[model samples]
Target chain A: MSKHLLIVSTSTVYGKGYLGYMEEEIKNFFGENKNIVFIPYARPGGISHDEYTEIARKKFEELGLSVKGIHEFENPKKAIAEADGFFTGGGNTYVLLKQLYENGLIEPLRNAVENGKPYMGTSAGSNITGLSICTTNDMPIVYPPSFKALQLVPFNINPHYLDPNPDSKHMGETRETRIKEFHFFNDQPVVGIREGSWLEVMGEDVTLCGELSARIFEQGKEPYEVPTGSKIKF
Target chain B: MSKHLLIVSTSTVYGKGYLGYMEEEIKNFFGENKNIVFIPYARPGGISHDEYTEIARKKFEELGLSVKGIHEFENPKKAIAEADGFFTGGGNTYVLLKQLYENGLIEPLRNAVENGKPYMGTSAGSNITGLSICTTNDMPIVYPPSFKALQLVPFNINPHYLDPNPDSKHMGETRETRIKEFHFFNDQPVVGIREGSWLEVMGEDVTLCGELSARIFEQGKEPYEVPTGSKIKF
Candidate 1:
């Protein structure tokens, strides 16, 4: 048993139905694991866990899989241990991580995933698979006990990575600039995945998927891009 | 003596020299308080405190004020108590707040401002004058001890607030959506100040300054805009 994860930048791409853009890949990733424990901690739009879980359940059902929200279980830790697969949806990363910590599911879920329980995450979900949630673009609507995340990957994930708009008049720090600031105090490498792109990790191997090139920011190095299908070697 | 503060959305508006756009207002806000202590903890672009202070010193020098970085003092608390005024330049809010806590400056600075120290803040600086840094637009590269801030105003300030672009194909949550998510977990009202705009606070009175309108988001109420110079009552 080895690590198997599908870390997605977004659950829904612009103009695409929920998970429609990655339907083929998702189906392939789940394979025969039909019972997915949906971690709806990252409730996008602040929807309830049950409501967010239903969105994932309906989408997974179309692919012949059954989904259940982790909150629906009597014991979330036990639920993680017994689940055949996992799917964490996107929302506010801080809220999701806070709930995960509060439920004490971080270790259980990490153990399950490390033992080859299939895991899929989009945006905020994808963020936790990294070293820490420090690079996430989501607001700190809530505070997690720690920025430390499940070390499923050696690097951090910056979801929804946007290129600088040279024509814009906005003074907000660009995604690249923000990451640069992170490197000032942090030493971890950050993989910035754009919309419609994802990282497919099988055991020790991690590769960039989808049609777009992903940006890589390493501490003390100039940020660069790795084309689709390239191995993300930090 | 009364609460006197200048909370700005951004330190520099697009196409304007740093502090150039609000020279008159900044001068008026400072009045005859010429000796200023600058908090460079935000450290935009990861510059050292001394380097960041140099930037502010040069800018304020144009206005006939002598600026010194707080880091220069052996006792920061004493520096706050003895300074004629204060100016906190913008960078990363988490970093700023974290350093403030690390140095035990939050209480001193808040008390100083409450006693009419003529405090001015741009971006991250402006954010701390509010109830919490939960509504900031900066990345949480570093975790502060707490999200609690100066509470100079009753509401949170979402500095560098941008309106949703109807034409955007990107799926990231808009500023409005993010603030809405914030309300789901916290009850504090949020003031979304755009670039070139600021809030002028005199005692308990807070009025929107600059030429642009500011958006206000209150829990359970739809976000609405109040024109420039309008008293932000909600």
Candidate 2:
């Protein structure tokens, strides 16, 4: 079976509850699956692993799905292999990848997702689905052995991507400028998934989901905005 | 002899010419040094090394200083060691560190600065003056051999740091939140140098420079603002 993924841009959009906007779609995405192996390695606000897992569990329980953190298992690799579905929450990408590498769960997680076990990721979790975490917006709090990631998708995912505010006085590089710099070093295409937007990956198709449009960056070409519900072709 | 470093937060503040804000201070910082080697590996906007260097050269010429690009030298390590002073312009920190390591210029540059030679950096350039580039705001467009930097200073520096806008609708983590997440993994104290402000290092003293207050983030302590010209401790 081909891969199925829900790559969410963020866990909570502005003024929304945690994972609120995509709850219904997420529930239907893993229909009949009652238990999800939660990867709380990202740990937003530096919350404890158990605390982060509990937040995810509470959200999933509302949809009749129980959640268990990968850390709760003695063997994380085995836990991912036997998991009915997976939910990777967002926080810091560097720390999450570091733990993923240290636990030797990269291959097992990839295999599970490739074998049709549904997988959903928000922010840093969604970032891991790309070829590398080079485009992440998080601080490099920790360093992983490699920038290479799970390669679940053909392009890079820049979660929670925002457009530059024209009225702002800050002089930092804009999101568009940063992505263009990425093109300078790599040839991979990048998808700038905006807030409340996500990539819904079915067997062989990836569709842009949500109300807002997403930006697509290709090397040596102008980045263009694509409407929501549009299919993405790498 | 102790090092003399000028760690600027940005090359050009908004609506200012390149290096315009600190030109006179930079001139006095060098104190009759006629030649300065320029490291343009950061290459903002993905410009070529020569193009980036010329921009620096033009700015320095106004101060009656001669400039040479490190890339133009046959032996980059030798060029760094023989230079009267050093100037690292800002761009992508990853690309800058990668080149520094790849060309074996890290040790040479560090030695020159530690030996009391004047060295200046802006944005990504200044980020390297700290223990590591972990706190940079730039995108990781490329992977470097290591995240280790010059270690010219004990703590890490967060360049172009901006406070969160209370009225904004953006959902991304604020700079302060990102740095706090950094503290969860590492114990290094981080200095958030905002635009138009910089750190002046002479001998063993490090003082906040310019007209604005800089934010300081220490482990387990609330971030405090240090006024201009105040000496920083811890």
Candidate 3:
């Protein structure tokens, strides 16, 4: 059976508080699994791991679900394997993957999620669920051993994906252009998960969640949008 | 003496043809240096090296200069060493650096620039002139051997640097926040070179050229804007 995963594009939507929009969804998703191990490896804006974990702690506290930071454990690998559920917050994807590899928690985390444990991720966390982090929007502040990430999903995820702004005068490559470039070197499909959108994966049933449609790009195929509630098998 | 380097933030500005806005400046900078070796490894949008080179060739031809792609030569190292001047166009910084390392051209290119050979770069090209490509806006399509760049300048360069759009609904990290995250793991200064801005390095003097001001970011110091034509010693 496939793992139970909720890969959110972003924790906070525009003008929304931290995980505010999905509070009810999160509460329902965790269900009776109150012991959620929080992984805050992707430190956004250079925030300390403890500080980042605190943000998640406060959010889950309101839901009456206890959250423990992965860093609080003596061995992160063991902690991930024994955790009842997992919730990895968003930040810098590169840093997140780097720490995961460093702590040797990649396999343990993968096993935990694959064994039917509840797993939830947002932004950088969702990025790691993909095949690799080549599709991430974060800067490479630190070099990981490799760009390889957890292969929970068959394809890659580009979180917080935005369409090209026609009004903007900037000439930088758009999100579409970047994904196209990724196809040049990689054959994997890329799902452009827009903010406020997410993927709900439960035992081979991968449904697009939220109000917005997600864009999907496959190798040698034209990019197309899939509406919310559509099953994304790939 | 240092080299003659025109590190442009981008090759093309909005509403302008490719390299159109700075044609005159490029012509003046090249002067009588007709034989320009072009490095097209950046390959924007999966464009072939030959195709990218053709674009540069057409532009330089109009400026009364000859251009040759580095890939056309058997020995890319010798090409860099023997060229009168060099021009690396913008594309994907990761791919550009990867190719440089693969072809063993980084050291030779650095030597050529340090030996007073004229060098002009736009976008990804300018990114390589910095100490590292940590502040680049490009997606990491490939894993480079290292993030270490040509190091022509003592600081890192963030080409096509954009300020946060006040009206936009996007909640993604701004250019400033991204650069700040870079500082969390790195200590080198970063120059946010805006669109249309170019840095002219003649010997030890680094003057910010073009019409708009550039933002300078140091680890501990507040990121401040430098007026156009101001010298950036750091």
DockQ for every model comes to 0.84, 0.83, 0.84
Q: Measured by TM-score, how close is model 1 to the native structure?
A: 0.99
Interface RMSD of 1: 0.7
Measured with C-alpha atoms, the lDDT of residue A2 in candidate 2 is: 81
- Residue B41 miss distance in model 3 (angstroms): 0.4
Query: What DockQ number belongs to candidate 3?
Result: 0.84
Error of 3 at A53 (Å): 0.9
Q: Summarize candidate 3's per-residue lDDT along B133-198 as a digit string, tens digits.
A: 888888998999999999988999999999988887887899999999999999999999999999
Task: Please state the error at residue B51 of candidate 1 in Å.
Answer: 1.2
Question: Per-candidate TM vs. native?
Answer: 0.99, 0.99, 0.98
Model 1 lDDT per residue over B1-234, tens place: 998999999999988999999998888888899999999999999999999999999989999889999999999998998899999999999999999999999888998899889999999999999999989888889888899999999999999989999999899999999999999999989999999999999999999999799999999999999999899875
Lowest lDDT sum, 10 consecutive residues, model 3 chain A, at A75-84
**Candidate 3 C-alpha lDDT tens digits along A73-189:** 998877887688999998899899999999888888898899889999999999999999999999888899899898988999999999998887989999999999999999999
Which is better, 2 or 3, measured by DockQ? 3
- Which residue pairs of candidate 1 clash? none
Per-residue lDDT of model 2, residues A101-213, tens digit only: 99998988988999989999999999999999999999988889998999999999999899999987788899999999999999999999999999999877999999799
